[model samples]
Target: MLRAEWTKIRTLRSTVITLALVFVIAVGLGVVSLTSVRIAFERGLPLVREDFEPVTDAMVSVLYAQLALAAFGVLVICGEYGGGMIRTSLTAVPSRGRFYAAKIAVCASVALVLSYATVFATFLTAHWTLGKYGPSWSSDGAIRVVLGTPLYLTLLCLFALGVGTLLRHTALALTVVLSFVFVLSPLATVVPGLREVAHYLPDQAGSSIVKVGQQADPVIGPWAGLLVLAAWTAVSLIGGYLVLRGRDA
Candidate 1:
């Protein structure tokens, strides 16, 4: 079953396009953002800004880029439904749990690999470029950014998959996931009380796991933040499994 699904995913143009975009956008954003930061620093513009930090440039890039990744993750499942492939898939593998598990495994594996690649590229690019300025690659947060960035991104992809499975509609799932990642959390920055709660938001928590910078208003530490995000993923996936079993395929 796993092998079959793997072959199906490989043959699909959407899978290739989605993963390619993941690589391009993830690496491209990091490279561009770091280069711009370096240029600004060279021109005597201060590197430290309101929310930007030079030490975690790579981390920031991955965090932002994961939004794109999350969308791809959602599409991976929802696209099947959109194209009427779910029925065929279920027919081939009658045990819905097995099919879902296979997808989860494939998505998690691919996400980890791609996420690591993006993080590695970002680290190498930013480290070399930033060295020309002032902040050395050997700085305090450098290692964390290199190591934690991929883990954060991988979890986010899983989170999005869980949501996509539960929602089953690409458009609806995309709307919910985007609202959580972009609009809701950022919007929470304004409301004083919500700002604290917002840090516990799925994307917010995941971002904190990858954050190498010192935040002015950190609600939770890295591990705890990741736990929060993981909890969200876990609940959604479990709920999705139940829904898949209960529903008529």
Candidate 2:
């Protein structure tokens, strides 16, 4: 089942194109951001050293690359539905549970590999661009950030996959996921009192894994933040599974 699902993903041209975009955008924007920061520092910008996080700044493009990954997740299942392939898939598997599990497994595995590649490429590009201003692998929390990048991205893909499964529409799933990631979450900052609640948002929580030093009064630590994001992913997947099981594909 997993192999079948993997084949489906591999055969899709969008999968290759989207993953390539993820790599390019992540590394390209990372170099630009790190270089900009290095230039600012050289000009003696008023930024304090303790307040600057070279590591996180270098990988700033991860936030944007996540949109592409989320879109990839949405297209994974929703594309099948869009093309009326879900019925055939269900007919072949006979068990929606196994089918969905296979889809999730394949999606997550591919996302993990792509995300790790993006992170490594972005880190190396930033290092090459910023030279001594870039964070070293031996720096505190650097290794954690590198390792956690894939986990963060994989969980996000799974979350989007769950949402896509439940919604079963590519456009609708993309709209909801993109709005949540880009629009709604950032709105919490200026809404008053919502900032506290927003700290537990999937993006915000998952982001903790990649950040070094203290942020502005985070509700949880990095590990705890990831647990919160995982909890959200679990809820999404469970809800999606229940919906898929109860409905006719």
Instruction: Report the number of the highest-TM-score candidate.
Output: 2
Worst 10 residues of 1 by lDDT: 209-218
In candidate 2, clashing pairs total 0
1-249: candidate 2 lDDT, tens digit per residue: 998998888888987787778888898888777777788778888654566776777667987899999899988899899999899999999998999999998999999999999998888787788888888898778888889878998998899999998999999998988888888889986699898888889988888888886542356777777888899889988988999999988
Q: Which stretches of candidate 2 lie over 4 Å from their true place?
A: 45-50, 214-217
When summed lDDT is taken over every stretch of 10 residues in candidate 2, the lowest stretch is 213-222
C-alpha RMSD by candidate, in order: 2.0, 1.8
Write model 1 residue lDDT over 1-249, tens digit each, in one string: 778767766788877787777777766776777788778867878754766655565556667677778887887788888898889989998998888899888888888888888878766766776666434557666666567767778788888888898889988998998898779998997788787789888888867755665652366877787788889888888887888888876
For each candidate, give its TM-score against the true structure: 0.92, 0.94
Clashing pairs in 1: none
* lDDT over C-alpha atoms for residue 118 of model 1: 81
- Per-model tally of clashing residue pairs: 0, 0
